[model samples]
Target: MKQKPIHPALEPYLEGKVLLVNKPLHWTSFDAVRKIRGFSRITKIGHAGTLDPLASGLLIICTGKFTKKINEYMGMEKEYTGSITLGASTPTYDLESEPENQQDISHITEEMIHAATAQFTGPIMQVPPSHSAIKKDGKPVYLAARKGIDVELEPRPITIYSFEITRIELPVVHFKVVCSTGTYIRSLANDYGKALGVGGYLSSLCRTRIGNFSLEYALSVDAIGAEIQHLKNSYIPPAGGYTDAV
Candidate 1:
């Protein structure tokens, strides 16, 4: 395979840099950052936001001085597209848990799905899932949940910029959502099921955008590593190392 040239600017990762990476499925946000760190000597790197291992999409990675702006980038609104399966609920609110309490979805209609979205639009009170990474007593709630411990959580306000139905099967609903930074789409799925009087759980999720960054422009792990290698070998050199005459 032909090697792609590295951008001139990426060589100075220690100074500061921002990279748009397309996170792969089953990979945590930190996993992507670790791969990038391996490509360079810079160790101040951090991802602007977190994506669950089950979700894949745009991940903004910052190095050196740019790491300070992670919170700012994380606060921006996000866009996601995914499928939710109705008529069954899960302990984790997604396929990560076993499907339970199946209900008849034959009675659900497209009109009902469209009309139900109105209730979730704009400002709404949302409760995060119990199996989430939220902290309780200085420990992650999911950790407690895995031990069969029940945790009480209060509803917090979140804004849903827009919610649209992209497709529908009897028990599966594919949709797009633009929501605030703290919004949990899993909660939205659970609430949506309650609205229709049929339990539901998230089956698949893919984040498409974050603020102005889109996954379409992101590079894969291998592509990024290769670019970094190219930069170090073909361009950058050690401070005391001298090159041969051109």
Candidate 2:
């Protein structure tokens, strides 16, 4: 979809400022960057990290010269709060896909849920979700998976610093997790369910933190655009407000 044009004021800030944006759910990280670029009226905008379409949270965007710092931010740890529906499996490992079936989860206990979380903490091997953006044979895994092509993907190591079950109601579990950069929460949800002898898939996901930045510091894309419009043809300013908010 074509993005609307930027407001007049923000054109000036597009020159070389970093933007902290709160990415909305169901929007790709690229979508957020594109929107920001449109608002800032700069062609040199980029995001530090990628967030799944089902995830929402802080998305650090750099414009012009600030784009140099993208790699630095991408390496930071991330935190998330999400819900997993137990007793079900989805092709996408999330609510975005059709669930194959729902298992009977009446026997699951709160204690088991708590214990299951521990297994995922610390270093663990995780297989990337088949319906993910991960490249396999030069094509996104999701594309191959959708084409009914079975691809062999090995499990790789990823550290999960923390995984806590905040709430549990039979087949639904709410959790908060802090982990390394490459960790995939959807895969975690799938693995967690399997560990418990049931199935599970991510129902909702919200990124709370990424490295030193948090969602608390992010500006809505509209708000950032408004600020951009207020600055206009003036020289773009430093990312003072951007850093402070994140």
Candidate 3:
């Protein structure tokens, strides 16, 4: 049987390469990985961290030997920018679920919002959302949540390097946060609204950075696919035949 052409450019990816992808909204982290794997044809690909389908931004995808570095990358600090909608809560803590438990934010003031940040900044214990990917009894807690089962989760310590409230427009509060690996911005929004005596939920989220890697340097899945196509297009088969490996 004839073998497929293996371009020299693809060799680097098979050996190992870290790709920065700007994950699109409503797409799971796995979706982005699958798209890259399909085009790059590198089976040993994995993403450093998981982003909720409601959230978007920088996703670090490692291929081949670089997959081993996923854990290391997962432990690094992350930075995010998003808007938290006060006066309403959600089951998923974000827009993935319907908003509920509405409250009046008439009493909420800019001073109160700024003060709330201090409570979450630095080291604090936070509970992960019940409707989250966190495993419980060998299954994702979200699976149980969907069946109306309540999962009790203990609070875990996470450092919020900084939490800056950049804009405030009544029910919507835009902010930037630099936090530790395990920090969940959804929980932070909930807690912040609670601190202000008004329930809150994450309306929109975008991870701008993970450690030193920024979303600005990342490319979309389509762009990466085009790059792969370009490389394949420029392929020059060896004298005998194409490579046996993809």
**Maximum-TM-score candidate:** 3
Model 2 bad stretches (over 4 Å) = 1-15, 233-246
lDDT of 2 by residue, 176-241 (tens): 999998888999999998998889999999988988788998998899877765555443446652
lDDT of 3 by residue, 89-120 (tens): 98888888899998999989899999889989
lDDT of 1 at 58: 87
TM-score of each: 0.91, 0.88, 0.94
Q: What Cα-based lDDT does every candidate model obtain? A: 0.86, 0.83, 0.91
Worst 10 residues of 3 by lDDT: 1-10
* lDDT, candidate 2, at 63: 79
Model 2 poorest 10 in a row by lDDT: 237-246
Ranking by lDDT: 3, 1, 2
Model 3: residues with Cα > 4 Å off, grouped in runs: 1-8, 241-246
**Of models 2 and 3, which has the larger TM-score?**
3
In order, how many clashes per candidate?
Answer: 0, 6, 0
Q: Which is better, 1 or 3, measured by TM-score?
A: 3
Model 2: lDDT of residue 241: 29
